[model samples]
Target: MSMIKTIKSLPMAVAAAAVLAALPMPEGTPIFGEQTAFAQRAESNKKQSTRKVQALTADFHKKLQKAQEAIDAKNYAEGMEILDDALARKANDYERAVAWQLKAQVFYEQDDVRGTISAYEKILQFADSIPEALEIGIIYNLGQLYYSEEDFDKALEYIQRWQNRVDPTLISVSNLQFIANLHYVRNEFEECLKYIYQAIEIGNSLETVEVKESWYSIALSSHWELGQYEKVRDVLEILLINWPKPRYWTQLAGIYQELGDEQTSYSLTEAAYKQGFLDDNETQLVNVAQIQLARSAPIKCAWILEKAFKENRVEKSPKNEKILGQCYMMAYEYEKALEPLSKAAAGDEDGDLWFQIGQVQMQLGHYKDALDSFASVIKAFEKDKSEKAKEKTLSATMQRGQAFTELKRFKEAREAFKTAKRMATDRRDKRMVTQWESYLKAEEAREEMLNG
Candidate 1:
């Protein structure tokens, strides 16, 4: 299961908007090596001079460069023919690696995934013969190719190699964020966090939201999986500030709930509701009401739930009706509570809804209505085997006794109390039933004396 539940339906934070941030260096300066590669450049220049004296090998190199240019010009057949001629001659591994790299580019341009992969792998096999800069470039592009094909394992493997080779300052924050996303897809959340936070820091310094969504998503999910609720909230807050979407708001409030901070959760959901972000979502609307109810604001809870139900914004299911009924009862709106409570109880077999209805009726001084609700509770309990289920039965029978006593029905009150005693599931409950019976007997004697 994904630790961040809300991300699944949202836009996937792929590396779609990635852009490499680089220095405005001299044209030939390698991205990973500024002046650090000067010795390698000098040695390469010496190699060029050495190759220039050998006419045949020099011709092979020039033909390979022409092939690359041909491929770039969309002349694939010409490029392949030149490359075949160049390869038919005896060539060094370095020259062959360059030829394969160009071949891969042509195949990629034609959307030949298998050919691109094969060519790239062939180039990597000459790893020792390839220049350091070209090696890093090849590994990075390999990661990109595998990622494009959704082969995340190979993509991550090559990307990690590229990351290992580069100067951290040279690679774009977007690339780092992409690596983080790969880790996220693979469920290596801890490593995902390491790279994503680096990406976020770089992105913050650069002041770009281009891949910020992806960075924050990976961060949020990673922190959540690590059980770092506060960090999860931090990422969510960043996303909410920049994005301000309903989903982020809900996720932010949900993280608050996970942290056991209902006050913050309730306030945050209320904020979303006030901003009209949650008005159209039934689950969000219900969440808002639940938060309000938790905070002892049942009037607001009932108002939101009742209006949503009436406006057809939310479904009027039995479970929802029960919640609505409870909201009304908590708000002391017994008359309004009765309708949904009755509807809920009518459809429920566990008797919990009936117990709720009886509580509401008893509070409203409706003794007969309360008695009927308790009867339903008892009948439901008759078929239930668990002692936990029987708990409600004991409470309902005792309530029935109270209802009978209130209606001045002494014989029925004694009978109800006797049933309560028989239904009790434990010594503690049995003692409570015994006390109710004693109280009922005293009331009976007092009533008989008064009548005499």
Candidate 2:
């Protein structure tokens, strides 16, 4: 997340200070004759001390200049050695800052992030002696440094210091975003929201400011974690307008669904689906279709499923095909339901899809076709010994008996009902099968009476 890098030359201190300092200390001889030699000695010592300070000051500059050159030449170790000596000899705060600034540059050039941070922070110790611009840079670097170390509180502290010192007009979008990120990384969401919004607001105003997608997403995530759905809605609208990806559209629809606004959610997803943004993603396609089903728009739901099925976009798995068939059935389009149901039943070994196909055909008064589908269900389960499969086989046998009765084939119907009764294991299924057999017997007796 860090982007800050490289270095700027330390603001030069006036080199002429060496010349002025090199001048002899003000001459002072004692007025007392008794202490004249002692006075001379004191004066000599004072002058010597002054010269020593001047030499230190000059030597510090010379070393600082060489260190800066080494840094410029990309010789960080050499630059650091000279800077260490410069730091040792600095005669005042200004000289110390010069050495510290060079040290920071050397560390930064060596790609030692932590060491660079130390050097920059050390420069701030003499803030009174540094230019305002350089001081602001140091403060900003402290924020960047602590942010790199994941010490968010100190990062924010330094960033806030920089913000307080500088004019509001001087604060850039990148700076605000960095401050916002520090708050975000620390889980201080509310504080994060404040700076990020301003960053976005500022970024929106300037063509040069590239407001990245992360800025908006961070806002969205914070709002979501806070359970501030309305804010989430607002940010999503802006995101949809700015960078309209399918995930964003899907999430926006989901937000509406969370609010119990199913119709709106379905409409939004339908719109994206129609615009082709959701096509490549099967889950998104199914989501859009499911939303319609949830909204009671079964006809529209069926149309979407059928169209995707036709385009081979939605998988033709039995599960998917059954859903398509169910959508048509829910819309009262039984004939339309049969096509996908037939395909679903074709390769299905468990017989569940075949049962559904049988029911739809029976509803459409296709008794023979219904009987055939029901037979497929029983045949599929005959080899399976699972109790669940036995129950399904029994149910299919009963359904087939009904289809035979529908076709007026009384003998076949009666035999089918008896088989179903024999196969029934559950008492409820056995009772139901017995009831159907009694009805078949009564119908056979009536037919015999009519023939006689």
**Number of the top candidate by TM-score?**
2
Best by lDDT: 1
Across residues 231-302, which tens digit of lDDT does each residue of candidate 1 receive?
989888989998889989889989888888878888889999999888789999988888778889888888
Could you tell me the lDDT of residue 363 within candidate 1?
A: 87
TM-score (all chains, Cα) for each model? 0.68, 0.70
Clash tally for model 1? 0
What residue runs in model 2 are displaced by over 4 Å at the alpha carbon? 1-56, 88-91, 127-133, 160-173, 200-214, 242-245, 294-299, 310-312, 331-336, 342-354, 363-394, 403-415, 422-452
- TM-score, prediction 1: 0.68
lDDT of candidate 2 vs native?
0.72
RMSD after Cα superposition, model 2: 11.9
